[model samples]
Target: MMKLDFKNRIALYYLMATSVISILAFVFIYFMVKDTMYDSLDHSLSYEARKHLSEIAVVADTIYFTHKKEWEETEHREVQINPVFLQLMDTEGQIMDKSPNLKEDHLVMNHAFSGDTHYNTQLKDRPIRQTQIDIKQEGTVKGYIVAAIPIESSLMVLSNLSRTLLGLFPLTMVMLFLISRYLAGKSIRPISAIIHTTGRITKNNLGERVPLPTQKDELYDLSTSINGLLNRIEEALEREKQFTSDASHELRTPLSTLRGTLEILVRKERNISEYEENIRKSLVEVDRMSEIVEQLLFLARNGQASDPSLQQTVALAVLVDEVLSRQHKAIKAKQLRISMESNSWGNFEVPYYYGSVILENILGNAIKYSHMDGRVVIELNGDPAGCYCLVTDQGVGIKAEDLDHIYYPFFRSDYLKHKQIKGLGLGLSIARKAALAIGAKITIDSELGNWTAVRVSFDQKVS
Candidate 1:
């Protein structure tokens, strides 16, 4: 099938509807005109028949015109140009007399006609409208009178009318189609503008937006929707670019440290103990790079829908214990005092890995940021609706301005930078992704030089 543009399609549909309506209208008009012409002819024929019937005198079962001079009048005797024909018949269905206009073609008496009945038949190879009625004298049937008039003139008028309408129909439709196309194009001009504006937008030119119409119609809504979609695309592209730059910088730092260590070790012959120390430092750098790669891959996976395989009924107390065990070395090194308060039914339905990642990152950050002997409180609560955890740490807390940005990938606070925390600033970002994938919420509250609190809330009812 061939595809038509919007304007042509609209015009074509309109033309189809108009054409049908026009044809019906023309047919109605033609019939109306034809009926009116027949009426006029029938009226004239009746007048002629009555005029001649009045001149007849019937005496003793015989009928004859009383005035012969009226019959000899030229106007009544003419045969051409809308002439009327009259005939008189006796009781046996016989033509007694006829108009001079009919010549030898006598008006045939139709047996089917009885009284004042008008009908149509052929006369001299031309059409004629006729009416027949009986004559009476002394309460007995005497004779019949028939009246007819040639209808060629009226038929010719009807023929010309039909031809005119048929000939003008195509021309009228053509003109209507052109006007409809023009109006249709005008109505849809906004769509063309939208296409042109969007064609200019690209990855590098995402700031461009389609112009909006002043009238708030469907086209305006469409333009706004397209602009909204473009805005989302632009934000996503910006995030992609930032992620690429951050990943490159983070990867480069480990590679550069490894290269510097190996270069120094090769500069001189060192004792076995010294060489072992340098090799161990290089291994630490390799481990940091591996951790960054693993976190990046986890983020990518969680960006899509959460994995169903990892979803299970997890006990919050058990998960917290596992996370604390992994961070025990840091907690002991900082001499942090840890406390736990949890409900007995502190179980949540969530992806297992998602719950693990959220707990591990939050606990690790609490341990890594706490001061010596500072209290790290872990609380858990649950109900039929959901379970929640709170991890509060007395640490070099974030500034008020940095609290909002903690979930951004590779976003580190000025306090963490100065304190030289052993982290790549990805733990909270990874936790945020995992929490969102599991339909959980994480919130942070912190005061500079006071304390930092992180809350993780999970819904038990969600499958």
Candidate 2:
């Protein structure tokens, strides 16, 4: 079956409910009337059957007439002998007495005894609901009294009832239908209001919220969830707008600088060495601008840059070893003996491309900051609460106050803040963002003169 929509579903529900109730009511009335009417007829038939039997009582093996309530006082030749109908018969199949409706004194083919109490015989002209009963005398089969009454009254009552039902049925159904329609509308008003409110809201017009239905039913719950979803969407939209504005501001100055430097270099042709030096410096600035733009794009995209095929269940222990070994070139070039520790649960089920990038940035930062021939203890493991990759480098570490600002874009440690560091101070920021995308948290602990230990922990439990 095809599904019914809400309006029709409500209509059908009302229709079935009313139909059941109406049928029960009609059937109850019908049965009650029939039973009560039959009881009254039965009582009258009992007396009539008893009286007719008494008149045909047996006396000395011969049937004698007794009761004569229905006998004529005088005979008149002109007046038609009232139809001989009521009769009484003997056990030997002899009729002793009869009303004027009978043809002979005894029954012809079939006989009814006095004791025949209650039974029916049908007639064709109309329904003839008749009853026959027996009349007995002193334990002997005597005679019968068949008391019959035409079912004219029952027919008339039923005919009237049927007519009344025919006339009233359509009107009752119409009334019920109207009642159902009204009820359905009343029940669905909240839904209609919700639709109206929802129509008013668009992507650009998320400020409008649906009003909770006053009834506080299912509609209220629906409204609350929709409103919460809209709130999240609005927040995301605002973040995008802010990013667009900040990106323009951040890119504008670098582009102008690169343009001015290129213009100056192109104006005059210098000798090879001088030209080479100037061009390298100019290229460095250009590279800085390029890196900044790439970082901004990377931040904007977040994890959208990840290739789905690169995702795999990787061994974190092996990853740590690989990163340490890879960073050995940069590690020794920076002149630091970096230690290694491994106790991951054991491997990370993640993408390899993004994982390598995350490790390179983190480890590269440690090597860059480490002192010449200094100790950089790299612990790949932690106790209990999940795995850890801790890199504590012995170098001019972060100032106590600058720790919080270190992860902000273009923010550097006080020592490296003024110096021409290779990065625009976004390596830690990018590493933290990538960590977040893959479900990890980064923590930092440092002192001005001691060491800077950056911990990228694979948290045992997710918040």
Candidate 3:
């Protein structure tokens, strides 16, 4: 089977509809013309019948023409142009006078026809229209008169009209199809433009957008939707590129440090104490690498859809205590002051692993970045709106410009560039991902050399 393109399909359907309408119009026109021609023929035969009946006179018991010579005129005799035939007969159905045009072909008297009825019958092997009119004398039947006329010219006119309509049908349809196809092509030109623009776009070049039409129609909506999709794809690809670059840089530093430590240890025959020291140093770098790997794996898992099976209601204040306990050593080493206000009125339901990762990252960052002898405060509470946990740290705070990008992976602030802070910059990134996966919101408020407060708010249902 041959397939039609969109443009051709539109044209074909329009043509099919047009063909049906044209056929009906042609049939109506043909019948109307046919009826008009036959009506004129009937009128002419009636006029002749009335004229011949007037020329006759009924005297006593006999009936004859009042003017015999008037009935012998050439108009009634000639058969060149449309000729009229006339005839006369008595009630006994005897031979009657007829038009010279009829010659030996006399009009047949139908006794079955009683009234002045007009009908169609054959005359001398040709089609003719006839009618019978009864002549009366004082309500007594005297004789009958019949009149007929040929119908060749009327039939010829009808036949010509039919042939003209038949000849023009296909031609008119072809013209209509062409016009419809042109209009359809103009209407859908924007779609072609969209296909072309989108075909040239790829993962590496997703900046291209489909052009929008001026009319705010369905096609305009389609173009806007496609552009929106392209925008999302481009943003995702950019994030992937940044992640790959940052992961490579972060992994290389640890491997290089471990390789350097091992190279120095095997350079000479060191004593057991020295070997132990070197092994311990190498192990610290290996541990750091393993931690980074774990964080990266957790980040990857957070990108997936959350599983409902892992969800459980947790006492948020108790969870915060656990996270703070895990970072006890760091807090103790810094000699930081800790304060907690646990006013939590509800238990938040969230995925266990996600909740753990989010709270740990935020609490760990609070402890890690705090100054020695600095104060760290944690507050867990719930309101009618939702549940919230806030961690405020008196730390080397982030700059205003860097706050917007703090959740990007491996995006450490420049303020901590030369500091002795130990971090891989994935903490906030993991925290944000975990928070988002469990339908929570994390907001950070920080100022340079002041304080940074991280707030996590859970949905009302979970609260």
> How many residue pairs collide in each prediction?
1, 17, 0
Residue range 121-234, candidate 2, lDDT tens digits = 543343334455655566655655555555666767977876776677667877887788788888888788878988888878888887887767787999898888888777
Q: For candidate 3, report its TM-score.
A: 0.75
Ranking of candidates on lDDT, top first: 1, 3, 2
* lDDT of each residue in 185-253, candidate 1, tens digit only: 998999999999999888889999999999999999999999999987886676667667777888999
lDDT agreement with native, every candidate:
0.83, 0.66, 0.82
Candidate 1 TM-score, true structure as reference:
0.76
lDDT of 1: 0.83
Query: Candidate 3's residue-wise lDDT over 81-196, tens digit each?
Result: 77887787888887556667777778888898776687778887787878889988889888888888888777788889999999999899999999999999999899889989
What's the lDDT for residue 227 in model 2? 88
Clashes of 3: 0
Of the candidates shown, which would achieve the greatest lDDT relative to the real structure?
1
- TM-score per candidate, in order? 0.76, 0.68, 0.75
Residue 63's lDDT in candidate 2: 59
- Which of the predicted structures, 1 or 2, would earn the higher TM-score when compared with the native? 1
- For model 2, the stretches where C-alpha displacement exceeds 4 angstroms are 1-9, 20-65, 68-128, 133-145, 150-183, 186-190, 203-232, 235-239, 265-294, 301-311, 325-329, 344-358, 371-373, 382-384, 395-416, 459-463
Which should have the higher lDDT, number 2 or number 3?
A: 3
Candidate 3 residue-wise lDDT at 34: 86
